[model samples]
Target chain A: MEHTQEEIRKHVKIYISVFAALAALTVITVAVSYLDLPLAGAIALALIIATVKASLVAAFFMHLISEKQIIFWILLLTFAFFLVLLFIPAMTS
Target chain B: MSDMIRYISKPHPVTGVTNAKLGIWCFLASEVMLFGALFSAYILLRTGATEWPVGADLLNVPLATVNTLILIASSVTIVMSWASLAMKDLSRFRIYMGLTILLACAFLVVKGFEYGAKFEHHHFPNSSTFYAIYYTLTGLHGLHIVGGIVVNLYLLFPGSAMWQTEPERFLGRIECAGLYWHFVDLVWIFLFPVLYLL
Candidate 1:
């Protein structure tokens, strides 16, 4: 799906906003790390922030939010297989 | 001709994207699995170890933090470059793409110093399980940055001639490169916390 110049101009604004959010999130994550929480808590908080950051990148920069159905299915299948891979190690341990 | 690829410059009517776009997503899917497996290995090994080293204490958090921000900036710049092309501004595209490449190189320079410091203090990959996983993950991520730099450089200079012949197709290439670059940044987002914070 091709965006018009107007839509792209609008996207440039969103891109800048996402960049600011990502930069702030990066700093927040680092500060949270220095709090020296317990390992499990640190892991949980850090992962949550990282997931949000990843989502922003995927949705905006990668255009997954407006992406086509075929790409969605492809990613879903990949995620399913990826979960199975992670589960193997978890189940074994 | 039967040999001609129909969707090089246009989206397939059904699939809704050019072949290059779909192909890159498939490639990224495989990459996700590759990194996912390594992350799983990291989880298992750390869980099994009687004592896993605290990440910040053992690794360099401040430097990793800077690198993380640098990569995030590059991700934004890359998307901006793509946007510039979409709007038919080749010179603006060049500037944004050039910034993306420069930020990528800056990330590597920071990584180099981090690694050099590690080696100076005798923190080789074989130093322990933590160091091993640390090197493996970050090293692979670094290589991805290098790959992004190479692709962005091509798009910035020699490969840019395609814009004259087929601007839309060339823009598609930029979109693909931007996607790949963002994925690399996404990987680092997780890696920083996993290797440096946790």
Candidate 2:
């Protein structure tokens, strides 16, 4: 399970690049928010950008990309329940 | 027996991951539900309201932007700390972890100022649906930050002694903490736009 020196260096490089990407995306999110798009359009754009940023953090930073299948199953279940939670409002309405 | 401890520390034969990692993921699964419920409530409240103030008008975007950078910086440092330990560089690990804690503090201080400004303007949770959701969402997220700081501080200080005796387990613990910290930052990533920008 030990990482070679080269692997460690590679990871550090990836971390730095991910940091830069997250920061750049944040700036883009803020800039786009200022546009006078329709409300739904703005919300969709914002959430989409946020989702991309979240994916980066989860995949690279949290190492979820190479995680075990059990963990993915756990998250899939959580996502299912989360969808159910969101749909309750729509159903009621 | 030592085998039992080893079983917990090493990846399971079937799952190919350590017990600590499995436990943390399970805990995070529950956390997703907790926050998901609150977020669902938020969507319901916002959609149901007749009039809702634009979030940008009420919130301090510049301040939150700074806070977002701070959290992002901390997230990097936390992962770097774990990386340093993995590379057997304790000195660098200490430096990185210390920076992570300091950045976490900076985020809270800036957030406190934001809250203070709201109160000074007589904006409370009951001020409007916007303020109510703002305070609740940010407040809950702030509490998570505090929890992360507490765990990270323990590992950086008193709990660091474990590194000498059980480096692998110590690294695993830090990785778990980093996972939680990254999740906190992820929550804020969404929160920044949802609460501040949108």
Candidate 3:
């Protein structure tokens, strides 16, 4: 699909905003590592921040939010499989 | 009969995406599984261990933090390069794409230094379970980066000629490359915090 010049310019603004958010989140994650939290708490906080950062990149940079229905289906299946793989260790343990 | 390709310049009527777009996503789906399995392995190892080392203690967090920003910046540049094509500015596309490639190279150089330092300190993959997994995961990711650089270099130079003949198809190719590059960056988003910070 072709994007108009104006549309791309609009998207560019969002890209920059995402970049800033990502940069800030990166710093925050590192800073959180220095805190005196328990190991489990630290892991949760860091991963929560990281998941937010990953979502921004996927939604905006990868343009997955507006992507086609079929692609979403593919990703949905992939996510399902991902969940299954994640659960394997838990089940075995 | 002429040997020509279809679905390159335009979206397929059924799928609503060009062939390249669909193909790349499917490829990326497989990639997710590949990395996801490794991530699963990581969880298993960590949870089962009685004594796990702190990543920040053994690793260079500052260097990794810098690498994270570099990858994030490269992701933006890659997308901008695709946008530049949509704006019908080939030169702008080249500039952004070139910046993306250079930033990626800078990341590799920094990683090389990190790896070099590790070797100097005798932190080989066999040093411990930590070093082994660190090298395996990051080393595989590094290979992916090398693969991206090769594709991006082609698109930036010789492959760009297609832009003149088939602009839409060329744009599609850029979009695919951007998707791949962004996936690599996304992997790092997780790898950074999971490996270094936590």
Over A2-92, each residue of candidate 2 has an lDDT whose tens digit, in order, gives 6788888898999999999999998999999888899999999999999999999999999987788989998999899989998998888
Candidate 1 residue-wise lDDT, B119-144, digit = tens? 99999999999999999998998898
Report iRMS values in order.
0.9, 0.9, 0.8
TM-score of chain B of each: 0.97, 0.96, 0.97
User: In terms of DockQ, which candidate is strongest?
Assistant: 3
Candidate 1 clash figure, as a count? 0
Question: How does model 3 score on DockQ?
Answer: 0.88
Report clash pairs, candidate 1.
Answer: none
Q: lDDT (0-100) at residue B187 of candidate 3?
A: 93
**CAPRI band for model 1:** high
Superposed by TM-score, candidate 3 places the C-alpha of residue B73 at a distance from the truth, in angstroms, of 0.5
- For model 1, the superposed segments whose C-alpha errors exceed 4 Å read B1-3
Predicted complexes: DockQ each = 0.87, 0.83, 0.88
Mark the 10 consecutive residues where model 1 chain B has the least summed lDDT. Answer: B1-10
Arrange candidates by lDDT, descending: 3, 1, 2
Evaluate all candidate structures by whole-model CA lDDT and list the values in order: 0.92, 0.90, 0.93
What is the Å distance of residue B197 in model 2 from its true position? 1.3
